[model samples]
Target: MIAAISENDIKKLKEDLKQKGYKLTPQRRAIVDTIIAGKGSHLTAEEIYDEVKKLCPEIGLATVYRTIILLEEIGLIYKLELNDGCSRYELANKDEVHRHHHLVCNKCGSVIEVQDDLLENLETEIEKKYNFKIKDHSVKFFGLCSECRKDG
Candidate 1:
C-alpha cells in the first residue's frame, strides 16, 4: 500500500536535500513514499528495499544505503542500531518526537517506546556533576513483553 505523506512534506524534503547538495531522484522518492506509508517507527533497509523494488526494480541496495545515510545526515530520519546488530530507521518530526529508551520483547522482537522524564533528569545531573556536555544518548531495556510473559 502506498503511504500518505503530504505534498508539502515531499516538497520540504526535496528542498532540504537540495540544500545538502543531493538530488531527489525517483528511487529515493519511492523509498520516502514507502516510509511515509508505514505505521510503525522501526524499518530496516531491506524492508525499504523491498518496498521500493515494487516501484523500481532496478534500484540497488547500495543506493538505498546511500540514500538512507544522506537522509540521516539531514535529520530527516533516525538510525536505530539495535542490540541484535541490525540498523533500523524512523522518521523524526515534532509530532512523533524522539523518546529515550525502549521496552523490547526478546521473544517476539517487538519494540515499544518508553517515556521517562527521570532518565532525562539523570542525564542532566550527570552532565552537571561531571562538568561535561551531553549531546545525545540511546537506551534499551530487553525482556519479555506482557503478552509474552503471560504466555510463558
Candidate 2:
C-alpha cells in the first residue's frame, strides 16, 4: 500500500519545480506522486515507470528515467546502489539533520529503513581529522531478514 502525501508537500514540490523552470505537467505530477506514495520502498526506475504508466498511459520509460535523474539532481530524491545491480530511489526527508540507513535483505531483496543516525561519530571524526565538510551520506547493510533467517 502507498502512503498518503500531504497537500503541503505537493504544493512545495510544485513551487520547487516552477523555480527550477520546469512546469509540473500531468506526467511529472504522476511520477512524483508515485514516488511519494512509495515512501519507504526504494523503487527502481522500471518499478516507478510501471506505476506511473498506470496513471498516465502515454508516459514513456525514457521520460520516467529522465525525470528520476532530474529529481535526484535537484536533491528531491536519493539514488541508492544496494549491490543488487539495480539502482533504487527514495524520497529525501525535509529534515536533513537525521538521515536514515538501509538494511537490505540479501535473500528476498527487501529494503528496510533504519532511522538511526549511526554515522554521527564517524562523520565528526572524519571532518575533524580531514578538515572536510560532510553534507550527506548513505549506508546499507546487506544481510538476511528475519523471515529469511528463520527459513534458513
Candidate 3:
C-alpha cells in the first residue's frame, strides 16, 4: 500500500516546484492532491484524469499526462511497471526509505504491497563485488493470491 502525503509535504512540494522554476498551477495542484488522496490505489493516467476532472472540469487528458511526467521528472512520484500492461503511479517516499515491493496475483490481477526491503544484502553484495552503485530497485512477485488460490 502507498503511504499518505501530509499537508506539510504538499507545501514542501510546492516550494520545491517554485525553486525549480516551475509554477504550481491550479490544475497541477489538483492533480497532485488527487494522487495524494488516492495513496494506495496506484492510479493510472486515465484514472487520474477522471478524478481530476471532477475537481477541475476544464482539465484535459493531455494536461494530466504532462503533469504526471513533470511530477515523475521532479522525483515526486514513481512510475511503476507492474507487468499488468498499464503503468501505475505512487508517491515517492519522502524519507528516502527503501520502496516496498509488490506481489501481483496472476489469476486475479490484484497487487499486494510487500513493505520489507528484501534486497538489502543483495544490493550490498552487488555493490561490494561489482563496484556498481545501486540507486534504486523494484521487485514484483507473480503468483496466485489467497482468494485466487482458493478459487483455483
Q: Top TM-score: which candidate number?
A: 3
lDDT by residue for model 1 (1-152), tens: 88687788888888999998988899988888777676466889999898889899999999999998998888778788767778998766535333456778889888987665346687779999999887667778889999999999
Query: Which candidate leads in lDDT?
Result: 3
lDDT for model 3, please. 0.87
Model 2 scores a TM of: 0.90
List pairs with backbone clashes in candidate 2.
none
Local error of candidate 2 at 151, Å? 2.0
Q: What is the lDDT of residue 23 in candidate 2?
A: 74
lDDT of each: 0.81, 0.87, 0.87
Q: Write the per-residue lDDT of candidate 3 for residues 61-85, one digit (tens) a residue.
A: 9999999998998888999887888
Off by over 4 Å in 1: 96-100, 115-118
Off by over 4 Å in 3: 1-7
Q: For model 3, what is the error of residue 9's alpha carbon versus the real structure, in angstroms, after optimal superposition?
A: 1.8
TM-scores for every candidate against the unseen true structure: 0.85, 0.90, 0.91
CA RMSD, predictions in order? 2.2, 1.7, 2.4
Instruction: Using lDDT as the measure, name the better of candidate 1 and candidate 3.
Output: 3
After TM-score superposition, what is the CA distance of residue 51 in candidate 2 from its true location, in Å?
1.0
